[model samples]
Target: MDAEIGYLTPGRTRRRSIARTIFAGSIGNTVEWFDWTIYTVFAIYFSNQFFPSQDTTVALLATFSVFAIGFFMRPLGGWLIGTFSDRHGRRSALTLSILLMAVPSLVIALLPTYSQIGVFAPILLVLARMTQGLSVGGEYGAATTFLTESAPAKRRGFYGSFLFLSIALGLLIASGIAWVLTNNLNRTQMELFGWRIPFLIGGLASLIGLWLRRNVDETQAYKDMANKGEIPKRSLRWIWRHHRPAVLRLIGTSVLPAFSFYLFVSYLPIYAIQRGGATPEVAFRASTVSIAIFMCALPFFGRFSDRFGRKPQLIAFACAYLFFLYPVVNSVGSGFWSVLLVECFGLLAYGLYASIAPAMMAELFNTEVRAVGIGAFYNVVIALLGGTTPYLMAWLQSINLESWFLVYVCAGAAISLYSFIEMPETRGKTLD
Candidate 1:
């Protein structure tokens, strides 16, 4: 780590320069989500190709179970990489994680199917997912913190929304890739070779993202901390001792957004193709369209929070989301227009939470423990709410209680709503 640094007074950059930094921070996040969400979309096809076990459904369940494991590994990724980020620089951490994810995706793309390698294929699948998981786990904290810090104070909330917008873009790419492969390839082709295209695309994007990130400046906030040698060596301890309330607050606040986001992007396709009598191609098309709109809407809400404060935006979204959980989900069975109508509203509400989360979470702590505190808390909630949600929905479906599953999602939003109502706003406030 170089000790050389300089002072940066607030509000001192060209608009284009600031936009570049935000884009750089955002692209890597976009690539990460591309690879991550691609795994889920393609799993429907490749789970059978790679993991041919007793039952395809059961194998997919197990595969996704391991998929959830990747998320579980994220806290460690956050703690280790985040500590390095807090101690050294967020740029370094962000760069390393992007490359970490790229390599695994490429390798997984090239791996042989079950017929060629037997059980070793899925084992390799699990191993690759774990590696990607570790990278993404660290990537979120580092990148989110980087963008929040790099963003101008007046626009931090809106700029931090870049994190989710990029995530939505990544998901869009994943859906597009899946759609192309499924539509263009014959069943034989998809099962054998077509499935690799998305992973290859993801890996290549990650590399390009790595190059883009190199041009961005180290965050001025982290630079100042380094100049003074004031970074906490044990940020986890500080968070545990001084910031536990904030951590708990973040976990509760994170649940509704996390749940709804995953429900829309991660599980909805599964529901459509498997339960709603839609083809894979149809499901991907609907989801792709919905995500494109969601991505575009993020910046609007992101900027909205900056003007309106975080709490009210979150509260309004929470109430609307709880009301729509079951109705929107069930309405999707009606066909293209209906699915789009339902998902658009659902994802729009979700965008409110996702867009502001990175900035709001960063605000919960001073720069000292910002990374680890956000990482651990966010990962724990995602573990409970996001990682298990599809499985939970699947379980509910098995019990003939699909409507009851809506209750689970609505309940999560209510928890976050109450949490949001009480959580203080940090709009335009500087973190020291």
Candidate 2:
């Protein structure tokens, strides 16, 4: 670690600079996820606004289709922004991604409903989600790269956990907002206008995230690579040619976390409310508390990974999921308290994967093409799996095979378990 070449500061100044970088990077990442998770949180309420229908399930299906559409756009975002991050800089790429997200949130907040504009409402809503999907795709790569590269090798797991913690915080905030609106507004009022409030707030919050991200310093690893003129002529090409194994492994290992995250955390409220017959107020309230616990627990797992190792923690998560998936899904049928308990326990299992996964992925690639490598592989898997969890669950339920959804999640965890077994321990290892 060359202090002069890294933070462009030494001693206390460098430490302060690192802290600022973490805050700036993590906040923008949080906002990106906040914007994303809010769509799911409010979809049950706003489905009628965009796709008016007699059948509530039909309207929800349409809304979730658009949500999945946003995910399909992520790989493109990953390709564009990942290249930009590798070529230009992580700070610039991250700031641009946040800027892209802000516009969509604002549009969704103020856009006309189906009653006012007919089918164009859903069309525009889909367009907004497309833009957001792209933003989120790029945000992960830049944010993770920046966070991992900014920290000391020994503390990388601890620092990288903030990225996932931010995700939990984003979801927690979305759930809290949802709970507040549901508690205050009756169902009709929520359908009428209450759903727009969180989107408006998210849009405004994006501006603050953009401001914070603008001030973030470039990561030392990136700085060093740039100074040495090690940037690839085509970063993605380099990744494909030289790092295909790592990319494939990333896709494999990412399946469990991505699928489980979308299914367990993002889709929990919907599952609880729709299938379990829990009230929206009860569901959102439980989500808020459970996710808060998840967020707070992330740093502890990260620190633990720093002391122990990445593979073992991930292994623990996978084994837990493999064994508990059925029971967890079964318990949700018992009502709100049961759903709450399952979700809270699920978060602990998820923490093992979320808190340290970024550090492990970051360790797999050198700085020159790290962003592109991560963005492409991770986003593609998420696009194919994570983004479609809700839609898949809905379809499964429609077909009277909803139990298979749990089995599907378990299969992903099995794949991830094998990957974890194969993965080298990355704790205390310097970024390549």
Candidate 3:
């Protein structure tokens, strides 16, 4: 561990740089999630454009399958770019991830429909989603490490909370936009042109993400390790030799958050429509409202974690889910209020886990391999569980066993609960 990792003399100039770094790091997170989620938000509309299926459920399953394909690319992205970040620099990796995301958004925006290009349309859509997946695979690890390392040691949890703050905001904004589009456009309009609007907006927004990230400074921790010539030549080998325990903890801790986030947050709108028989507008509106509350609640949990401890909050939340998830999930019915209430309750429960994760994950590995370790561990879990969750839930429901989906998510939470029980408290620990 390097002694010089978090040193900073108090000054206005330095404070401003920290603010800029936080903004630069977090804004791209917003864009990355926005671009990623817009596909899910609009999947009901756009699925028909690419997948020419007579069965509506088949078409949606096809679209989500493409969404899952993008997720499969995440591990590769995490490994390659995370290794590059370990070898090169976080700033470079961060910038490259945002740029990679922008191109896919633009491609989806301009993509020809199956009506025009037939078989080629779905292929191009899958390719674009795969690229976006690659970008996000690297983005979360780089941005989380950057934000956590950039903050003052005691407040790392508070600052790191912004990663999910941005994610919640992104999903909130996407839901809002989707709601507006659904309300204004009829089914025909939405299927034909409305879906493209959000993708184009996301593409244009990526340029701003590129600009902000370019201006922010790199972390002192990474620079200190690099300057001292302590960075290992083979980062994966270093992890295997020294931090394999952390890797297991990472997987154990990562599964529930990844799985539940997709199930409760990303999949909520669709769930409302399919299981609850709500309208598209109602579902999107419910998500927008619930996510707004979720976004507002995150920093409070984060700051609380900074004061109390991450492990306690994580365990408490997991226990809450273990006890309440089945009841709450079963209570959901075909109404706007039921869907909205369930979504809010679920996100609030999730905030307890999401708020503390960035700091906890950063604290697990030393600076030498933090980015790659986080990128690989986190993305692999997300690829396997998070990406497949929506499809899994949909399939379960189709098979007349949707209750199994609830059980699956609860099982994931239980896994995380056990991991958190065994994990050490990293509160007030300096990023070294």
Candidate 4:
């Protein structure tokens, strides 16, 4: 590992440079997440377009199954793109990931319905989602490494929080658009065409993200590794051989965050509409409000982690979910206010982990392997747990055994709490 340097020392790296880096890193992330979130948010409208099933639940199941299938490609994305980032540079990899996401999003926007093209419609949708899965799989690691490495050591937590801040922004934009479309268009109109608008918007916005990412400087950490000729042989076998424990630690730390994140941010709104008796508009409105609040709270928690410690906040998050998630989820009612309140509480707890997760995870590996290390294992966990959350919830709900899903989440929280307790504190730690 290269020794920590004064590359980001106060006088050397100006505030403006850091601000631009944060914006560049965050904007692309926002676009990536926007595309991902819109798929779920708009799935209800479009599920029948591709699946053509009589049973609404069956169509949704098929849609969400495709969602999980997309996740199957994430680990490969993480490995390939992560290695590319580690070898080429964060900026290049980020730009490539956005390009990957942009094309597939546009494809989804213009895709023909099952009635127009028969079984090919669903097949095309699956292929598009798989490609998007690849893009986002790579996006998280490269962007997280870029932001965390670019920040001053002491402020890594605060800066890292922007990742989820961007994510919240993306979710808010998606939910707001859904609200507008649902309000303005009739159900038939939405089912027929309105769902494609957000995908179209996502595809176009990605170009802006690409431009911003292309203009940003490569992270100094990567530059330093290059200058020192310390770039390691990029291989999954090598990473597994040397960084095995770190990989396991990351997976353990990620389980609860992965499950709870998808549960709160993506699936819960659907649950509210389907089971909690809230209307679609009410669910979207509540989601929009709660995400806005979650976005606002991320930086505060990030800053707090810098002051207190990452472990403390992460522990609190796990403990809260472990003990309170069942009750909180159960208490959700049909009202907009009830949904909003439950979402806000859950997301705030998640913010504690989201704020500093990038910094904490990046600190676990040396510069040579940081991006790939995180990309490989973190995404695998996300693919396995996070990507499956919505499907599992829907499946459980279908079986009238939804409460069992809560048990699964609590188990994940228990694992994460143990991981947090055992993991070393990373506050203010310089990245390897």
Per-candidate TM-score against the hidden true structure: 0.90, 0.89, 0.89, 0.90
Number of clashes in every candidate structure?
Answer: 0, 0, 0, 0
lDDT (C-alpha) at residue 120 in model 3: 93
How would you encode candidate 4's per-residue C-alpha lDDT over 1-432 as one tens digit per residue?
233456556545677787898999899878988898899878999999999888998998799888878788888889889999999889999999999899999999999999999999999999999999999889888999999999988889999999989988887788678778989999999998899999999999998888888889898889988998756677989988998888888989999988877788667888788778999779867877888888999999989988888999999999999999899888888999999999987899999999999989998998888888998888888877877776677689899888788889899999999999999987877765
User: In angstroms, how far off is 391's CA in candidate 1?
Assistant: 0.9
Write one digit per residue (lDDT tens) for candidate 2, span 1-432. Answer: 586556565666867877787788799877888899889878998998888889999999888888878889998898888889989998899899999999999999999988899988888999999999889999889888989988899988999999989887887777678768989999999878898999999999999999888877787778888898656667566677898888878988998988777666667777777778888768766766777888899889999999998888999999999998788767685366877887887887998889987798899988878887898889999888876776687788899788888888899989999998988787888886
Q: Which stretches of candidate 4 lie above 4 Å from their native place? A: 1-13, 52-60, 114-120, 267-284, 334-337
**Regions of candidate 1 where Cα sits further than 4 Å from its true position:** 1-13, 112-120, 267-284, 327-333
How would you order the candidates by lDDT, starting with the best?
A: 4, 3, 2, 1
Query: How many Å off is the CA of 172 in candidate 4?
Result: 1.0
Give the C-alpha miss distance for residue 14 in model 4, angstroms.
2.9
**Model 1, span 211-293: residue lDDT tens:** 88877789888887788866658756667788888987988898887778767766777677666777766776777788899
What does candidate 4 score on TM?
0.90
**Number of the candidate with higher TM-score, 1 or 2:** 1
Error of 3 at 429 (Å): 1.3
Give per-residue CA lDDT, model 3, range 153-219, as digits (tens). Answer: 8888889888999988887778779868888999999988899999999999998899888887788
Error of 4 at 363 (Å): 0.5
Q: Pick the candidate with the highest lDDT.
A: 4
Minimum summed lDDT over a 10-residue window in model 1 is located at 1-10
Q: Mark the 10 consecutive residues where model 3 has the least summed lDDT.
A: 1-10
